[model samples]
Target: MVIILESLLGSMFEALLDYSEGFILRQEVGGVG
Candidate 1:
């Protein structure tokens, strides 16, 4: 159970990072073009 929870949290954090990175990239592209 503990391992499962840890893995879930890790994935969530990774997803959040991916989302934020994409958002920043979009903003940069919009600003440039």
Candidate 2:
């Protein structure tokens, strides 16, 4: 159970990071390139 929760948390964190990275990248490029 703990392992499953940890895995899910990791995935959620990764998705959040990807979203943040995309947002920054868009800002730097002046568009969502």
Candidate 3:
């Protein structure tokens, strides 16, 4: 049970990181264009 929760939290954190990075990249591209 604990292990499952840990894995779930890890994935969520990773997804959040990916989303923020993508958002920042989009902003940079928009600025350049």
Q: Estimated TM-score per prediction?
A: 0.82, 0.80, 0.80
Please estimate how well model 2 matches the true structure, expressed as its whole-model Cα lDDT. 0.96
| lDDT against true structure, model 3 | 0.93
Model 3, residue 3: what's the lDDT? 100
Q: How does model 3 score by TM-score? A: 0.80
Candidates' lDDT values, in order?
Answer: 0.93, 0.96, 0.93
Off by over 4 Å in 1: 31-33
Clashes in predicted model 1: 0
Q: For candidate 1, what is the lDDT?
A: 0.93
The candidate, 2 or 3, that scores higher on lDDT is: 2
Winner by lDDT between candidate 2 and candidate 1:
2
RMSD of each: 2.4, 1.2, 2.4
Q: In candidate 1, what are the lDDT values of residues 1-33, reduced to their tens digit? A: 999999999999999999999889989899563
Q: Best lDDT goes to which candidate?
A: 2
- Candidate numbers, best TM-score first, in rank order: 1, 2, 3
